[model samples]
Target chain A: MTTLSLGAARAGVELRSFWRERDAVVFTFALPAVLLTLLGSLFSGVYEGSTVTSAQYLVPSMIAAGVASTTFVNLGIGIATDRDNGTLKRLRGLPMPPLAYLMGKVLLVLAVTFAEVLLLLAIGMVLFDLPLPASAARWLTLGWVFALGVVACSLMGVAASALPRSARSAAAVLNLPYVVLGFISGIYYTPIGALPDWVIQLGSVFPLKWMAQGFRSAFLPDTVLPQEVVPSWEHGRTALVLAAWCIGGLVLCLMTFGRRSRQTS
Target chain B: MTDHAVRVRGLRKSYRDTVAVDGLDLDIAVGEVRALLGPNGAGKTTTVEILEGHRSRDGGSVSVLGVDPARGGSSWRREIGIVLQATDDAGELTVAEMIRHVARYFPRPRGLDETLSLVGLESKRDSRIRRLSGGQRRRLDVALGIVGRPRLLFLDEPTTGFDPEARRQFWSTVRALDTTVLLTTHYLDEAEALADQVTVIAGGRVVAEGAPDTLGSRDVATVSWRDGREQTDDPAAVVARLTAAYGGPVPGLSVTRPSLEDVYLDLIGVPR
Candidate 1:
């Protein structure tokens, strides 16, 4: 069989293992949507001079965070667990190309992230009355942003997997930055304009901030534009930043992966 | 071109300041089951890992299946299967499912049913791997290892955690595989039971390499009679003389050669 086909088979196995862990599957799929519902209901007001409720504003922000959760956080913890449990070592010894193992993981994340995004969108539409993109241009923007965001975040996730010393500590190691990034990136607290300038600058240095901004542009209207930290959605810069992260993250992943002897064999 | 399944000379590896494998040499012919016997930290694992291509040796000329492991690519990897010690991954996958998942990596793989029976996991084919007992799980490990029908298999202390019964069962599973195997273990009886040739290493070097029974001194044998015991090269002659002197079967007469364990202890410089 071809290497790519082996990767596809590996993805099938990954998906099976992931889904069979019933609690993790439910929790992973439910966390962002649950938070959206609770936070959406708790923060009950429209932004000043705009009809878009705070809940509606949160929908897109949460979607971006949702993407990160599925790709970055999920992949990071999964890879670390694999490393700890001897999955990586076993795969390393196999005829499977190292690329195939990576491809399988990325494919798993892609599948899960799509499902996560759709779930969040469904909740936003039904519960918060958020509108889907009505324009082909908005849809196009959404596509590229989602694509680039997944690629960049997934690569970063693979790189980050090498940070945690073991599977037991992987959750804490990967999630701390994820939660902190959400706050500073305005996913947890929005109308990005409300945050301090330094916070905005710091948040902008990361991909989550740009991803949340891109999604906000796709979901929110021109009326909410001034509420953003920037007056307009910096589409070009968003693309540039996410693309740059993709390259940088790829390099980091290459540097860190296949390294020997962190865990006792 | 060589028919040896593995060949190594001066294989060395160190962890920072600690030398793990220092100038180790190994040779195993095709279809031979060679056991590497050593104490902990004697570089057995380091040597095996280097040969498996999972580790890089600091210095060595190593070839596995006619390819240098450090440079071994996917095709080279296909010819070898590895069962690592204490692998706890893929718990959520079922016995058959896990085997099938790995089988796809090889260009040609054993049939699912055939592989399952080979490792004696057919009864647990649909059971989750996590639910398997230790012995059964180990069988599954072997199932995954040999599913590709590799020409060479590396079993790194394959029966380390097994109970006596489980170890016996696992030995049979391994014995069923018609492939060259390089196993690492500290168990003398396990080495004697499974290995066609045993190589004992200490301090990262081969201390002795030969058939298990004759590893240390093939010439010496011990003869014990009711009246006396003596160590001599000609035990048959000693036994005959004792029987003739007694004018019947010599009372309490027993002839013994050095056991593999005795030889192993002597080889490793452990007094008994």
Candidate 2:
């Protein structure tokens, strides 16, 4: 009970602190929708060989990009700064469970990721004529995929946060790698077959590609599946891959945060 | 149950090969204001962190509020408040918001308004934390530290950067808390003014521990004249000899006890 209440309060504080910065608010919510329109319109709104609109592909891909953009950067840079600033040390000394602090960051990013996804989803479906999830079951799949993706990305963010020793370097370390993840993971358009097998392996190993594929499986029409590298909506494989990333990312987050806190204290 | 709020025996901590706290022992009775006095890099923070359970010690038997901090759980933590040695991290929340949020973590907390008034931040309650001045931020930190209504409070270098007036105000605030305060400070005056007892630590070991007024020849005056200074066992004897030599009161003679700073400097072996 205490953990839950503390988490709620932490989340409240995190959100208030987060939204106070106008740039962070715009970057997390507005940028994804704007990117979807620009990229979708630029690509002529059609997949290379399919009748499906390119917006449909970007709807899922850019959402993953958006999650990476905000949650990863937010968790990575925000937390390292917090650690450097002694915020984590102060919170660790509190009576609350240590996980409450972690939960607060995770919950804040998850909330923002949801809002980003919804704003993009609404734009994709309404303005771009991106198809809606066909059935209640499809919507349920979208729900789980969204939940898992945000969590996995946020966890990865927390884990990666420890990479940069100081707050000043965290943004560079965090955002630079994200561009690579997006490139290979088709967060932007790529001819999957033209790419080397190592690229496929690399993208599959991280959460970005799998999370994007999972979202596609839930939201994209069946006809667009061939355009995806896997050539079919491998829903089971998508779940397996995303679940692995989610669990693995969570473990990594716990270990990295534990180690960093010990060192700082 | 122990009558002491904190008890330690032979506490030890090392970072890799550097021993930070070497076999240090301390005891603080319940409701006592005990100050850990030492120069910087004298393991003051390391020792306090060990007690606060933020860092693990290599070897020691320690108890805080009757529970070993190393093994202490959430309920044990609830009984103690901690004011760290760093700046506040509220970042953007208003003064009241940060306090309210921190208060939710404790099982029993002081009222929000009451805590604000206690720290004299009621006037700045609506202001963003980033806009607060250094002293105001420090006061907010103390406010958050005590809002949980802790029975024992650990204040680590609480007034390190305050101006004279601010420091005095902070001293009074700390005195008014009415809780067992175990504070660490390098300022001898802070220890002299706020602590009932002061323990001087050097090289990670206690050199002396006693009531502040009686701590180290504090009552012995060092007689000084135009030519020399003498730390005498008997200042009156020195004074009488000087009076006889001059056939009256010694010219430019002044008798003064070593200030706490002088004693502290002597304790830490920083040549005076």
Let me know the TM-score candidate 1 reaches against the reference structure: 0.93
TM-scores computed on chain B for all candidates: 0.94, 0.90
Ten residues in sequence with the least summed lDDT for candidate 1 chain B? B211-220
lDDT of each: 0.88, 0.82
> Chain A TM-score per candidate?
0.95, 0.88
Tens-place lDDT per residue, model 2, A1-265, is 4788788888888888888966557655566678788887776646655667766667777877887777887888778878887688778778888778767887888788777877877878886787778889888888877777777787788899889999778767887888788788877764343457788788888878877777777777777666667677677887787889889998997899778866777
Question: DockQ values for all predictions?
Answer: 0.72, 0.66
TM-score of chain B of 2: 0.90
Query: Lowest-scoring 10 consecutive residues by lDDT in candidate 2 chain B?
Result: B84-93
Quote the B-chain TM-score, candidate 1.
0.94
The most accurate candidate by TM-score is 1
